[model samples]
Target: MEFQQTGELEEDVWFDDVDPMLLEPSNNLKQRKLSVALVDEEGTDGLTKHVAVDCEMVGVGYKGQESILARVSIVNEFGKCVYDKYVKPREKVTDYRTDVSGIKAHHIQSEAVLRKLLALAMRDIQGQMPISRTFQYLKKEIYFSMTFKEFKDAYEPCKKQVEGIFLLGPLMDKVTDFRRWEEFQDVQREVADIFKDRIIVGHALSNDLKVLFLGHPRRKVRDTSDYKPFRRLNKGSKPSLKKLAQVILNKTIQAGQHDSIEDACVAMKLYMLNRKEWERSNKSKGVLKQTKYFCTNDSKSIKDEKRRKIKIFKIRNLQKKRR
Candidate 1:
């Protein structure tokens, strides 16, 4: 369920620096090890903590040729939302990708742009309220001071009144100059800190890290896409998160638009399902390495022995014919 930062979890697998699998047949490995190498530079070095991460990207290239991070979400082991933020790109954005991303123009627009339009509307609505009422009384009014029960009761039924105010100009032309935004930088820094030296679990993680421009020690990444035991589910190919969740988790995900939090949680769940098996099987990597080495040498020796036998048989036949 949890791992210590240093050699503790590894010690369980490594068995005090001796691979227990050395006792097993060298050729009995189920498959090669499916772990990243232990050479990551920015590795986290405390108690080993794992966080599931998912990122949403929108195109930002020629004809929307490139993908840029528009949103990112991280969830803890207990499936709590730890970090979520919308990332604005540095270049002028080409598409908002409402279909999959659900990001709209207004969501990225600055307070300066939105506040001016909102202030006028707020002023008009403020006039509708009793001007003579004190601020204290206004706070307790029906729209402002509703109880939790009252709010939930009216939420769905009031959609008609709410729908109109939510609509904006089909959305203005996509806003530009996203890279300069301070919020995006702050988010990038926060994500880096959270992931620093911590094991990060995700599907197709390299793409997420690339888009985020963040570095994690490779050893700290437990990518579900490359996980070996799950390979058979997709016929030896790396599985998409959607497929892995459906098959391994017996639940559907990404049926509609992609949700980062949902994907992150699903990846975490899949890993948890096979954690013990995976760690146990990982110990066999040493055996696999040893097996391959011996197998290669054995194959060469067998070929040479057969060649010697064939040559000797031909020599004896020649002598018999001469006799």
Candidate 2:
């Protein structure tokens, strides 16, 4: 279902069910509040070091097969949404994938309109004014204009810019508050900061990390897809998050479109449930040492050395047979 354009901050309206513990007095105070809230949440005292993250994707390139991150969510140890934002894709979105991603056309259209309007505003200012001044002018002066026609009439100086940048007919009815938006790179940085020094829990997190262009130390990652017990349930194959949630958690998720918050919560819950066994297994296997080796150049050299030994062994066997 499409989100209604309420002209309020998207976060305020889009995530109605966010836990109270997740709420901060204001965005400016988020970091300060996070530490306190995390400690105070029931059953989450010592678990502040763990956070689960998930990403939702929209089809961007090539028949909508290529996935680009559109939304990302992070949940705390107690399954509270600590951060969630809809990101503006770098490329034009080819498919909203509303059925699967729950991203509606309107979610991105507002950003598109705002970008076009800002370009027009910038041209009108002729590089003489700071961007903040231009933004204030739009927010205070132009945004109040009730209709697209009114906006055009008020900013006649930018008529040429408008005509060149946007198709008037298509955006006629889509005027929305462009105040709330996040660029893909900004969101990536924010996600990286949130994940710093924290254990990341998720299902199939490699894809998420790859899209964000960030990496976590393998030792600090708890991917449900890579969990041995979960894999055993699927005959040693990597299981889907939906399948694992249903089988292991006895919970049904992703019934319709995927919700990053819900998926993150499920992952965190799974990790918490199996924390002891999982930690013990990793410890016994010396995952820390193994991960350090595999993450560096040494692993590649070792692989090459093993291949050389195998080749020599085969050559020696062949010579013996010939003799």
TM-score of each: 0.54, 0.59
lDDT by residue for model 1 over 86-201, one digit each (tens)?
A: 77565556776767875654445454555344333434454465433423332232113444444334333422323335222222122233233336678888888998767788
Model 2 clash pairs?
none
TM-score of 1: 0.54
Segments of candidate 1 deviating more than 4 angstroms:
1-48, 112-182, 286-323
Residue 134 in candidate 2, Cα distance off native in Å: 35
Residues 38-113, candidate 2: write the lDDT tens digits.
2224554333689998999898655787677888989888888889888877766778788898876445556555
Per-residue error (Å), model 1, residue 227: 0.7
Q: What is the clash tally of candidate 1?
A: 4
Locate the minimum summed-lDDT window of 10 residues in model 2. 27-36
Q: Alpha carbon lDDT of residue 142, candidate 2?
A: 33
In candidate 1 the C-alpha lDDT for residue 108 amounts to 56
Best by lDDT: 2
